[model samples]
Target chain A: MDILKEISENLELGDFEKVSLLTKKAIEEKIPVEKILKFGLIGGMDIVGEKYKTHQIFLPDVLMSARAMHAGMDVLKPFFIREGMPNSGKVILGTIQGDLHDIGKNLVGIMLKGAGFEVIDLGTDVSPEKFIETAKKEAAYIIGMSALLTTTMPMMRKVVELLKKEGLEDKVKTIIGGAPVSKDFAQSIGADAYGYDSTDAVESVRKLFNQA
Target chain B: MRPVLRFLEDELIERIVSEARDVLCKLGVEIHNKDVLSMLGEHGAKVNMDKYHVLFTNEIIDKALKTVPKSFKLYDVLGNQTHDFSGYDVYYTPGSAALNILDYDTNKIRRPETSDYIKFTKVVSGLKNIASQSTALIPADIHEKISDSYRLYLSLLFCEKPVVTGAFTIEAFEIMKELQIAVRGTEKELAQKPLTIFSCCPTSPVKWSDVTSQNLLDCSRFSIPVEFIAMPLSGFMAPVTLVGTLIQHTAETLSGVVISQLTNPGAPVLYGGSPAIFDLRFETTPMGAVETEMIDCAYNEIGKYLGMPTQAYISLSDSKQVDAQAGLESSMGATLAALSGINNIAGPGMLDFESCQSTEKLVLDNEICGMTLRMLKGIVPREDFPTLPRLEELLKEKHLLISEHTRKYLKEEFYFPSSVIDRANRTRWEKEGRVTLIKRAHAEVEKLTRDYAPSRLPEDIKKELTKLMMGEARRYDMKRLPEIEI
Candidate 1:
């Protein structure tokens, strides 16, 4: 069997150790880093995501598979850097300022990373300047903001405004989420997208890349 | 026999009540309101002002229980008594204070404004099985300072039924009384023909905060029935064991009852609760969980044993959307609450762990309530003698499909669900586009609104209410409320 297929199957089984070993063996056997990432780790996570969407697997099962995929990604990440190749793309995420809630944002981050995106999680209470600075530093394409409070939903709009002021409006896509944030609010604030939940966040990022 | 659901034996209920009294006497309840503390102290409660504790003796609780009437009547807008909380009469009201509403037209969830509250009130007013209306959606357009009183004003303006609502602050509580008095004409008449029952809650772990305790006292003084809602999050703010939580719940409720009765000897009170097990994984109170239904049933048993009219937060779904989980959890909780003989079940139309309100869910839950109440009625054999002869005579025919007995009792015996619950075969259902419950609910809402005429109110009273509400708005530095076309 192909090594990428083996790695994908092991990741599906949530056999992190096996995924790591197979990924390393594939590395040592001279498979390209980008090829291993796209055909193996991302391929495995795509199946897990679909399984989640279809209700075939729940949070715990998907989380276990995500960890296994991450294990494989860890083995392949340094090789990609050494070979001067991007994994998928960079994305910056955080719960917006005045909001201390991050569980939903963290879930989105995990899903993004599982989808093979290199996520720079800015954590909670992130200001618009912080998001912009991190997005600039990471050269991230998408900036995802989450706010659990209605009072802090405007911070998402401020971040978008800041991006526009910095002339980065066309360069970076912005997505907002949390309990109170909605698609209408996203449109009202001129955000590039709105993610109703964590899985929708990953899909929004994918759609952004596709549109680009 | 009537369908009955009980979780605890009479002995166990007594034991739980006994332990609850011990909890109150030993640990004591924390009452933050100074007036209530002083009042409790005057009533021979062991009050520690510095510690904010009021320890109730068996004498205090027994006296209070003796004075608390087993049932009371709630009146509607026209000063007609509508709700009789006498015995096993269970009524369903929608969940209260939801910040967001699912807009039927947009099919989007949004923070509701006053217009949306009006829409919700109209929909609820039309739902026949829903016994009372609640301020199901909080308007986001109003200022926080006036929101509570403003919501009460809207309830008075729109709902003709007895309202189930409450106030956030002492000022808001006073304003609510003013609105009630304006509707009922005078303070004495307000007390006599109470058009609303105020729900006052005690914080979990046996604590009654200053505001809520004061609201309890205010309601008692006004002669409005107060629903003492004790929400104990099991395993977190409350004890992990169901019995342990019940002990806390009973203690909290008993303390409220004692204070309320002391304030006014014959004040009406409802023993209501909204308890849920703290889910370790989700870190949420699953209002629709089986554990919640069990707790509601058990707590209600204690209420009945104490001869108090009871209420429970049931018919609520934890599901974010109206789907299978929503149907399963909501129907299960509603059925359990109904069978348990809870006097008032207040959670229809609530979703997302009771955070979001949906009129569609309310319509759907009206159907659920109808089914559950039908189940609660059980089967009533009309004739004293066995119908074996009639059955034999019917069986002699080719079929009993058109028997005289069947024709006589068919509609009376079974609850035929309205158009929302599809009972048609697959062929006919698909031919009719296989509409889902939510879509059907949307259609129901549309039909109701299109056919809607404002409930009759005297023109003078209407103008007075408008003037009073506008006066409130002007106090918040506004000329009038935001307008929406009726």
Candidate 2:
């Protein structure tokens, strides 16, 4: 009875168990892994993102969808690696050093993952060097830093300076965000962009790659 | 005799208060300030340091309630008593901290500047029914760092009424407290008269941020009157039911009371809230919603039962313009809040969910407030012990227009609205250019601003206020303060 449709519907409902079961069932039926990942998993998340953007759904609903998507993706990851299905992009995200606030950063991570971007979340209190070293190691397309305190806002500037010194500014784009961060602060620090909120973070990343 | 509105019976109020106390004792409230958390711990509360939660026992709650004054008095800049925030005596002030002003000329909402703030102060100063002036508009021309204190400075310079103000940052409180002191000369005199009432809001669903908690502690230390604005959006941040929201409001407010009383016993606080029904369709908190007003009245009853002065952000509209929607919503809110005996009714000149302020609407709401105050003075016999005498006099005169009884009680019995109410007949209305309510309100705003005299504060006090504000502005890299015509 249309196993991929069942998977997508279950993902949207945030039923992680049913989504995982349907993904395993689709794989057993010998449907191509790419079709399940695209039409089954990412298809459901796109709806969640749009509903969130329009305020038809709220944060809890979006977070539940992200969880359901992860459960299905866990089962599909091995198949994709074997078949070499490429993700849209990779991003490195973290809260700058001396700032412990991470709720906003975590929400952006969830939304980025829902949008089909592979997000490497370096947890809160991450140093500037850790952000760049990991970006260079993982070859991330964008590096996102967050700072909730005015004191820790300077760390974002340090990350930008290190990126310039290493001449990786052309290859890797930088985006700064937090309660105290603004577009003017971003320009003054020589960063590529500033994200006003979590939803805006996804759009900013897409703009950096000319994907929007 | 005063008309009163009661939404909850004694049994229901007792049940609700019991439930709130149980929630506070069992679930506890999360306070982000370290000093407050430890202080609560020292005061016999069960403190969960790891989670920053404090559980209050019945004894602690009772002790705090006993010390809270049932009422307080507010003094104007000249040390004249302006407001008695005691039982059933309602006072109207403009809503505070609006980021936008509904520009009279453009008929559009835009970021307010210092000039707009000055004009708002001038208009509020001229308003008769609005008892106190609020630091209502946040001027965009100033630095965000000093916006909180700057609003107060403008209100003190251009207006004389006791201000209803608040601070956004913990550091800003020092300057705000100093500004109040500059008016009254010293901390002791300032505390004695208490020229300002600070609004300290707790985060909804039983939590207080570090900044707001610190502000409460500081206000308590100086004996400054504070109103705990606990905003719980029903169906969203709070339970979907009205009673459930009331419980949350009670618990949040009680936690603030305990904090203040712990800092200094007998600290004055008003049981205030700004709860709204979160409209699922629009994803907005409509303050003017009927259920929102019901929550306000119900909680005011609870506050009165608890023996504390009450405040609410009612008598305001969520409408984007000063249209029929604004008038109806605001009138309904004012009537309900006044009958419910909310002592400080802080919602005039407010629109767009309290984000925008219009001086034109302030003029209209002033009349609404006057009507409500008149309604509060329910049908009472003035000089007519026998109704037959009044009827005979009315029958003899054929009209009571020039009779002694009419002359004595005409102003008392009837609320005379300004020209904004459109009392004239259609023919006369047409003769006067057939002006709409908006046009009439705009003209009144212009007349008030033009007729406003500069504040009568002593020249040295004015100079001192300017110097202190200039020092604060310079700290944020602003070289000069904005010029005011006065």
Candidate 3:
């Protein structure tokens, strides 16, 4: 990958061609995927994630970063498909039903990518049935959920219960996060993890993987 | 200092109280939900929940009013005396209420960098006319090297008067100590000159956060004065009537008084409230309207009646723009706050219904503060008339009253605007950039931010606070920060 393009894409500050060009450059140069993941994606996302936490950037920045991350990821998608393998872990994510906010969930997705995990972002307001079905089909190891509004935090509990009812709870790890979600709250809701931000979300997933 | 201003003398206060009283007794204030009604009834208030209205006899009102304390002190780390709200003028700002500008990197609004916060505070501090300044905006420019006490460091590095602020966590409070140490020169001194950090209770009838409660206790034990700021949305959260709102305010105040005095009686507690009806039409809380005047008059009376010093939110507004509406609201609010003898007023530099802060308004409001002081001076009587044998000499030469003494009186009594604001004739005013007050204000803010000199803090103390903030920032593994040009 063109180092500049990949770095800019991973940073979430640029657009599609920025990442495509960087990826194409790296591919032409025969640079390994592992090095591209660490130097470009990891480096870029580190900047974006910290900025989000400090009020220097807002939701629009998060969206832009996610788009860039995807642009870079798109080039790597085919290589992974050809190899028929996934790096790190497979995680499924969504904003619980009734909560339409996607900012926090999207950041978590970007951070997960930076952490070298494949994240299936189930766009917000996802129902219990959809979560169970996705977990089954993707056979994802980690279940990451986010909620921004207080009114929708309870869905975290409901989704967890529904997963148990479908007998998928033990089969997969469940984590919950959002503005309203607390560490104590996560325990009360019977979720395996609780994250307050993108960094916490990544850390929790890493811990989950370590324990497994 | 001028023996407390009377709300009755303030025309706006009178208008607001009478209008609110009529609205309550006639149309009545909305109780809205049954929960609020039930809560009031439990406190001996008569509630017509179906109509969403409440009525309280003087007896219930009195009982609630008795619960509040009149005066409170804010202490710095040295426990050096800074402000006493009961009978002094105190001015502060909002608690960074909205999640605006953030660090481009972390994207969290933890704190703005020390340099930025200092610049912001210096503008207010140098004004000197401002009584108290509480600005706890996070420093974003600082890299995520967490453990640094950004808020405390900046307040310590800049401000001179009492700073109204709060702690988000215990670690943050430790940093606050470092900030305090930096200002007062010694830990022992800051402990003695403990600051009057303001704690905000939930907006009406809501339980105080456990964290907030704990912080209050901690501040109390340290001899730091505490001010309980109860912000109730009249049409939304509290009573719809002026009197009912006072009762709600009374309950909130009384509970804090009990807690404050319970922990440290005469612990220098001040009673204050920032309540106004929510203008549902605009989806905003009108803080500087007649509604705000009523709030100041009634609640201040409750505090004064209890023989305790008081404070309230003045210099407020619900105008969405920094236009005539902004001027009207802020002017009226500042008048009410001063007239009612409030010890502290937060945020007068707001426009667009208090949604935005403008530097021009800051400069303009500084002028207004001077005007309000003149108004409080009240009508000058014959006592200062000088019997003017000198003026009489000039009168002897004139047909009527254009005497030199009269000229002197006119020149001395009338307050003049500074050159930045156009007070000149239209012909000349058109030449100076046609610059509106806001444009001038923006320029002023930029200048102040750049020219501000950081408060000289003791090196060790500054280092300690910085360490705490930077360390705390890092626990969350906060690394990079946004690049802010300003």
TM-score of each: 0.68, 0.69, 0.54
Off by over 4 Å in 1: A1-212, B105-108, B383-404, B484-486
Task: Report the number of backbone clashes for model 3.
Answer: 85
Q: Per-residue lDDT for B151 in model 2?
A: 94
Q: Which candidate is the best by TM-score?
A: 2
Q: Please write out the lDDT profile of model 2 over residues B106-209, one tens digit for every residue.
A: 89999999999999999999999999999999999899999999999999999999999999999999999999999999999988899999999999899999
Per-candidate Cα lDDT values, in order, are 0.86, 0.90, 0.62
**Residue B404 lDDT in model 1?**
52
- Screening candidate 2 with a backbone cut-off below 3 angstroms (N, C-alpha, C), the clashing residue pairs are none
Please provide, for model 1 over B321-352, each residue's C-alpha lDDT reduced to its tens digit, 9 standing for 90 to 100.
Answer: 87889889989999889988999899999998
- The fnat scores of all predictions, in order, read 0.00, 0.00, 0.00
> On residues B236-327, what C-alpha lDDT tens digit does candidate 3 reach at each position?
78777665666666655654554454454445566666677767787777777787677775677666655667666668555544567767
Model 2 agreement with the true structure over A107-191: per-residue lDDT tens digits: 7887788777899999899998999999999999799999889999998999999999999989899998888888889999999
Candidate 1, lDDT over the whole model: 0.86
lDDT of model 1 at position B322: 78
Query: Docking quality tier of candidate 3?
Result: incorrect
Residue A64 displacement in candidate 2 (angstroms): 78
